[model samples]
Target: MGVAAAQVVDPGSFKVHHVMFTELRKLVDRIIQIFPKIEAARPRCSSGIKALCSLNSAIDKAKLLLQYCSESSKLYLAITTDAIVSRCHKSKSLLEQGLCQIQSMVPVMLAVEISQIVDDLRAAKFIPDEFDEEAGKVVRELLQRGASASDSMEYAEIKALQTAASRLHITSLTAILIEKRSIKRLLEKVSDSDQQKKKILRYLLYLLRKYANQIIEEQTDDTTDRNEGAFGSNDPNTNFMHAHAFNVESGLENKGYDSHSDKLSIATLPEEFRCPISSRLMYDPVIIASGQTFERIWIQKWLDDGNDTCPKTGMKLAHLSLTQNATMKDMISKWCKKYGITIQDPSMQPDVPHLLETSSISIASFGSYINDLRLPLDISNISLGSLDASYTSDGSRNKNGDGLNLAPEQNSDDLRRDHSSGNASKLDLESLSSLAELDWESQYKMVEDMKNHLESDDLACFSMSSENFIEPLIKFLSTAHDLHDIRALKAGFQLLSTFLNQYRSGIRCLNEDTYSLLSLFLDSEVTKEILDIMEVLSCHRSCRSKIAASGAIISLLNILHSNIIDSRERAIKILRNLSLSTDVCSDLVCLECIPKFVPFLQDTTLARHCIVVLRNLCCNEEARASIAQTPGCIGSVAILLEIGSHEDQEHALDILLSLCSQCVEYCQLVMDESDIFAALFDVSVNGSEKGKASALELLRLLRVTNHDDRQQECFESSNVAPEDANNHAKEKKSHKALFGVKFPIFSKKKK
Candidate 1:
C-alpha cells in the first residue's frame, strides 16, 4: 500500500512539461496524503471497494496521458493543442468526481481526509498555456502550401517544414517516420466526411515522406552534405520505415479505385470503408454531427471525453446520437465480397440463448475486463443492484457531465401556450417586413444585431410571447435561400433559434408558413438552423398536422439515413415532437420511421427520444399494431431495456407489454424474439427498482396470454387426438409455446 501510494508523482517532481498537467498533479499530492488513512482502514463494503477501483481506473488514465505528452513528438503535441488540453481537463474532472464518490464510502476515520482531497481538487484550475507556437505555425504553413502549389514552389515548402522539425528537435529519419505514421493513424481515425481536412492530411503525409526521401537520396563528396546508410544499414524499424515511405507514396496520393490493381490483395482495402476509430472495415458504420462516419464504439468514446464535438470536423454536435449509415455499410459489405474478404460481427454470431453470457465484451487492449462489482470479495454473495447483462465498450452510456447539455430539458415544449396580443409587447412589425428587401450583406448584419439584442436584453426574450413576434422572425427565416444565402439564413435562423430557446412561449406563436418553410430548407446550407426551429415548433399540439403535411417528416426520414449527425438529431427531435399527435404517429408508421429510429437504440444521446416517441405512439392502437408488425423494432426495444436508463428501460418494458396486450399475434411476436425474452428475464431478476417492477409486470401479462392460448389449443386437441394419436407435433409446439419462460416468476398459489 505504501509503495502504491508513492507512485502518485507530485507537480514539483515532474521532469518535463510541468505546465501541462498542473491540475492533475495537485490532485495526486492530495491522494498521496490520504493514502495512509485508506490503507489502514481497508473498508470492505461493496461501495467502498467499488469507489476505490473507479478512482484507480481514473488515475491510470491520467498517468498514461501525462506519459504520452512527455514522450511524443513536440510538433504532434503542439498541433493537437485543444485535444491535449481537453485530456488534462478530463483527467482532473475524473479525479475530482471519483474522490467525491469515495468520501461517503470510506471508513469514518478517513472520511475527513477524503474531504480534504476534494478541497485540493476545487482549488486547482487547468488552463491551456501557450504551446510550441513556432512548430504549429510551420504545420499550418505546410498544409496551406500543399493545398495549392506545384514543384516550382515545392522546395521552399519542404525546406520550411524540415527547419521547423529541426527547431522542435526532430532530426533523425526514424523520428520523421514516427511522426509521419502518427499523422497517417490520425487520418485513418478521422472520417473523410470533411473533405478539405482529408485532403490536407494526405498532403501532409506526402510532404513528410518527401522530406525523408531527401535524406535517403542525397550523397556528399565533403562534410557539407552526406547521406550514407542514413537510417543505419541494418535496423528493422528503420528498414520498415524506408519501405513504408514507398508504399504510401502513391497509395494515399489519389483516393480512388485502381481497377488495374489486384482486387484480392489485402492492401486494397479502401480508406473510406475503414472506421475512423477502429481503422478496420466497418460492419456497422454510423454518422455523427460532423457528417463523418465512425465505428459506434470509438465515436461514443469521443463523447465520453466530455466535448460534444465531431472527431473529424471539430464542429460542435447538436446531440450525441449516431445514425446508422446503411449505404456505407452495404458498400463495405459488397466491397468485402468483391475482394473475397471476411468480416466479423459479434452480434451476428450464434450464441447461447441467455442474456448474462460472454457475448457482451469487446476491448482492443485486453481479453477480459474486471469492474468494481467484481473486485468486491463479498459482492456476488451480497447480490445487490447489478446484472450479468453488462454494457461493454460499444454499449449505451450517458454524456460525461462536462458537456454544455444535461438531459433535454424534460418536457420543455409542454410549457408553451399561444398568446393573442402582439401589440402589448410593442413589436415593430413594419421594420421586420423589410428584411426581404435588404441585400444579403446588409441583411446578415441586421440579423446579427437582432440576435445580440435577444441574447443580451431580457426584454427581447420577454417579447417572444407577442403573437406578432414570430411574424418578423419567420419573414427573416422563411425566404427561399440558396448557397449564397447561407450567411443571412444562418444568422436569421440563429436569431430564431435564440428566440425559441430563451422564451418558451415563442413556439405558441409559430404559424403555417413556419412549419411549411422548414421543408424547403432541408437541403440548404441552413439545414441546422431550420431543424432547430422545427424541433421546438413540432412540439406544439396545433403545429403537428402542418409539420407533417409539409413533407418535412419524409425529409427527416432521409436525413436520418444520411451521414451528418448534427442534422440527423435535430431531424429526429422534430419527428419525436411530431409523434405526440395520434395522426402524426400514424403518419410516421406509414412512412416506415420505426425501423430507422430502432437502429439508434444503443446510442446514448438519442435513446430516450427514440423510446419516448415509441412509447407515446404505442398509446394509439394502430401505431402499437404497426410496431408489433415491424421487424427488429421489438428486439431493439428489448436491447434498450438492458442498456437504457432506469426510466427508459421501464418504458421499453411498457411498450412490449402494450403490444402484447393487444392480441395473441402480438404476444407471439414478443415471444418470437429470443433477445427480447432474455432481456425481460434479466430485468425481472436483476434490474433497477422501477425496471424490475415493469419487467415482472410485462412477464405476467405474457404468461396470461400464453395460458389462454394453451387452453384453447387443448380444447380443440381433445376431440381430434382419439382418431389421430400421432399428432403430437401440434401438441408439442403448444407445450413449449411459453417461449422458454417458466411461470414461476409470478406463480399463483393453488387453493
Candidate 2:
C-alpha cells in the first residue's frame, strides 16, 4: 500500500510541488522584506512580527510536507503527511488572524502592501514562471496515472493551496469590501475549481450584503428613535410601509405585483443607500471623522447639538468638518435614477452658479445707473399742519400756490373739539394757501392741535414729518414773535422738536432754507427746546455748517450763561458737539465763549463737558491764550486735576500741558501753584500709563526750564541757607551732567 501510494504521487507531481513551495517561499520572503517598512510605517502595530512568523511557519510546513511526499516510501508517510497538513492549517489560521489585526490597526500603508500582494497573486494565479515546466510535466504524469489517484492527489494539493490563499486573501479583501462594486468584481473573477477560494469569495459577498443590510436597519432604528416622541412606536416605517402597501394594492388591483400577493416584488436596497442617522435614503451623503457615512443634514445637526463623539463608535471625534462622500452620493444617485425616484441634492443646485452671477450683474448695473442718476427732486412741498385760508393774502401765496391755511387762534374749546374729532387735515394745495392767509392766533391753534395729536400718538409725528411739514413748522417758528406770538412759537417749536426726535429724515429735511428760518429764533424764550432741536440736528454733518452759519454758537453760549442748570448742561453738550468742527470751534472762540466755560468748570456735573469744549477751542493758538487769560480758568483746571475722575484728570493734565507748551508764563503758573505741581508729581506716580507718562513729561519739561528757580524756592521755603541752596543747585546740575554715575554706597558710613 505504501509503494502504491508513493507511486501514485508521481515524480512529476513532486516536481510541481517543489516548484510551488519554492515560489510560495519566495513570495513569503518578499512579504517579509516589506515587514520592516510596514513596521516602520506603523510602529504602534504590535502584531506585525507575530503575523510574519505565522506566515513563515505555514510556508515552511508546506515545504516539509512536499519534501516528505516526494522522498519517502514509508507506510506511515500518509499519517505523517496528515499531521503536517493539520499543522500547516493551524499555522495558516494563525497567520490569517494576525494579518486581520494588522490590517485593522495599520490600515493606511500596510493595507496598500496587502492589496498589492493580493492583486499580484490573483493576476498570476499563484503560479510562478519558474514552475511552468514542472507544472506541464505534472499534468502529463497525472494523465498517465489512473484518473482516481491523479484526481485525489490534485485535489489534496489544490485544497491545501486554496486554504492558504483564502486565509491571506480575506485579510486584503476585508479591508476594502465596503466598496461593494469592487468586491463584487473580485468575487466574479474567483476560480470555481478552487472550492476554498470560492467559499471565501461567497463569504465575503455575504459580509458585504450583510453590511449593507445593517445600514438599513441602523437607519430604521435612528428614525424610530427620532419619531418615537410623536409616533409612540418602535418602528418608524410602520405608517409608511402600511400606506405604501395599501397604495400598491389599490393602484395595481389585478397586477401580478400587487401588495396582496404573497410574492410581492419588493426591492431590497443596500445599507449604503440609506443614512445611518435618519434611516432614509441619503440625498447628500457625507463622511465624518469616524470614517462613517451619514446624511449631511443629520450629521450637521449632531455637530450643532455639541456632541463631539461619533454615534456609531463612541470615539471622540477629532474634527467636526464633514467631507462630501462623492462616490456614495453618485451611487445613490444612479440607484435613484434607475428606480425613477426623484432626489433633491441639498448642495447647491446646478443652476445656482448662473443665478448668483446674474443677480450680481444686475445689482452692479443698477448701482452704476444710480451713480449716474441726478439727485432726487426736493419733495418739501408736502404741508405738515392744517391751514386756514383766513390769514393769507391772495398775492402772498407760497411758491407752489397751494391754497394752504395756517390754523388761526381758536378758543381752547375749538382746539379740543378739533382734536377729539380726529380730523387732522392732510397737507394739500388749499392748506398751503390757507397757511399764508391765516392770522397768528389761527396759526397758533393749528400748531397746537398738531402738537396735541403728536403727543397722544407719536406715529402722528412720523406722518407729519413724512409729509414735508418741517419746513412750514420751522418757517412759522421763525416768523412768530417772542412777546405776542409766544404760544404760537412754542407750539411750532414743540412740533418741530418732535419731528426731529421721531425721524432722522426730518432732521435731514432742514435744508439751508429751514436753517435760515431756525436762526431767527435763536434769541427766543423757547431757546431750551430750540437748543434741544439743534442738538439732534448737529448729529447730521450737513446740518452742522448750517447751524454754525446760523449764529447758533452765540445762542448756545448765551444759554450757557443762563441761570437754569438744565439749560446750562444742555448748552454745554450742544457746544461740545458743535466744537467737533474746527470752524465751529473757531466760531465759539470768536464769540468769546472761552470765558463762559470757566465758571461751569467748577460745576462737577458740567466739568467734563466744559473741559472738553475748552480742549477743542484751545486747538487754535488764539483760543489757547484766551483760555489761559480767562480769570480763574487755569486755577479751575488745576483744581480739576486734584479732584476729578481719571478721564477728567487726563484732560486737565492735557490742558495744562497745552497751555504750558504755548507760553512760559502758564508753565510758571503751574509751577507757582504747589497743588498743581504736587498733582503732576502724584499723577506721575499713580495715574494710568498714558496719563502718568504725560504727567512725567510735563514735570520733565518744568524741571528742564525752571529747575534752579524751583529748587531755590524749595530751599527758601524750608529755611535752608542761601549758600547751601547754591551748592545744592550746583550739585544737582553736576549730577545730571555726569553720564552713568553711581552714587556713593551709604552704609552707616564709618560708624
TM-score of each: 0.40, 0.39
Q: Please give me the total number of clashing residue pairs in predicted model 2.
A: 33
Per-residue lDDT of model 2, residues 398-488, tens digit only = 2222322212223455445434533343322122224535887777777776666555433333333323476566567667853457777
Q: Candidate 2, which segments miss by more than 4 Å at Cα?
A: 1-421, 424-434, 437-442, 459-467, 661-665, 684-690, 706-751
Q: List the global CA lDDT of all models.
A: 0.58, 0.53
Per-residue lDDT of candidate 1, residues 586-635 (tens digit): 88888767778877777888888889889988977777876887777888
Residue 191, model 1: Cα distance from true site in angstroms: 57
Worst 10 residues of 1 by lDDT: 370-379
Per-model RMSD to reference: 27.1, 38.1
Give the per-residue Cα lDDT of candidate 1 at 200: 47
